[model samples]
Target: MDVIYVIDILGTFAFAISGALVASKKEFDLFGVIILAFVTAVGGGMLRDILINSHPINWIGDLNYIYTILTAVVCTFLFKSKIAPLRKTFFLFDTIGISVFTLLGLQKGLSLNLPAIVAIIMGMVSAVFGGVIRDVLSREVPLIFKKEIYASACLTGGLIYLLMKQIGVNENVNFIISAIVIITIRTVSVIYKLQLPKIKDDIFTRNQ
Candidate 1:
């Protein structure tokens, strides 16, 4: 398998694990967990593919995606207790997945010769939409709604990758650098519990 393809499958499975955890927390049935896993694994890429007209979608043309998600979900379920204690490690995998998918999205957009703006948007979409779906399924407001810099990190990585290409840097080095930037930002944020301040609710503050 191509290196990129292998990364894509690993990314898919890691996100599936995230979704399965949420489903289990919600007391969802087996079928619901499967749906959650599949959606969290492929929803973002599918959305990006559709937007870019990358047709037939991703998981559809590749049954391996299904098998990968299934395996991830079952294994996650069997070891849920152990896995719960390793949230940070799983998040490392999730961040890697985000970086890989963002790069792939930018590549796909640029393959069509899309403008830099569009490519960045595609990259952000590819990275975060799956998390959005996962949050909604778990009955939580999606993180992107309040915006604590998750999508910003993806866009920053995409823009950096594009800048390096424009400057004629080695493509492989550019990829490594961009992915590192993303993972670093995500890791720091998680370690520090960093989040943008929420706008305080004040419905009672009326000028009557």
Candidate 2:
């Protein structure tokens, strides 16, 4: 199998686990957890593929994606107690998922001859919209809408990958560098509590 394919499967697993954990936290039953896991694993890719008019979507064309998500849900349930106390587990998996999904989505867009900007948007959508769906379902504010840099990291990585590809960077090197840049930026921002500057609360208050 292609290394990218392997990474994509792993990313799907990670996203599913993150979803399952969140569902558990929300006191969801088994069916709800499974549904959430499936959604979080492939919802973004499905949306992206639909937008691009890609036939069969992604998970539809690949049984491995479905299997991986089901396995992740099982593992999450089996080990929830052991892993639940690790507050950082969800963040770790989420960061990894976005990093892989972003590049894969960007690659797909480019393969379809999309514009760089559109490809970047596709990458961002693939990386975060699943989580957006998860958060919306769980009645929590999505991380991308928060002050922290979430989707921004994916967009930055997508842009960097496109720039390097245009300049003829080695494919493996470009992928590695872009993924690292995304993971590093996300980790550092969260660790240091860095955030994009927000409009002051008074602005909204004045509007009201």
Candidate 1: lDDT over CA atoms? 0.87
lDDT of each: 0.87, 0.89
Off by over 4 Å in 1: 197-208
TM-score of each: 0.89, 0.90
Model 2 agreement with the true structure over 1-208: per-residue lDDT tens digits? 2876777787888889888988998999999999899888899999999999998999899889999999999898888787678658667767876888999999999999999899999999998899889888889998779778888999999999999999999999999999999999999989998888777687768789
Please report how far candidate 2 places residue 49 from its true position, in Å.
0.6
Off by over 4 Å in 2: 86-90, 201-208
- lDDT for 61 (candidate 1): 83
Steric overlap count per candidate: 0, 0
Tens digit of per-residue lDDT, candidate 1, span 45-135:
8889998888879888889999999999889878888888887777777888899899988988999889999998998898899889888
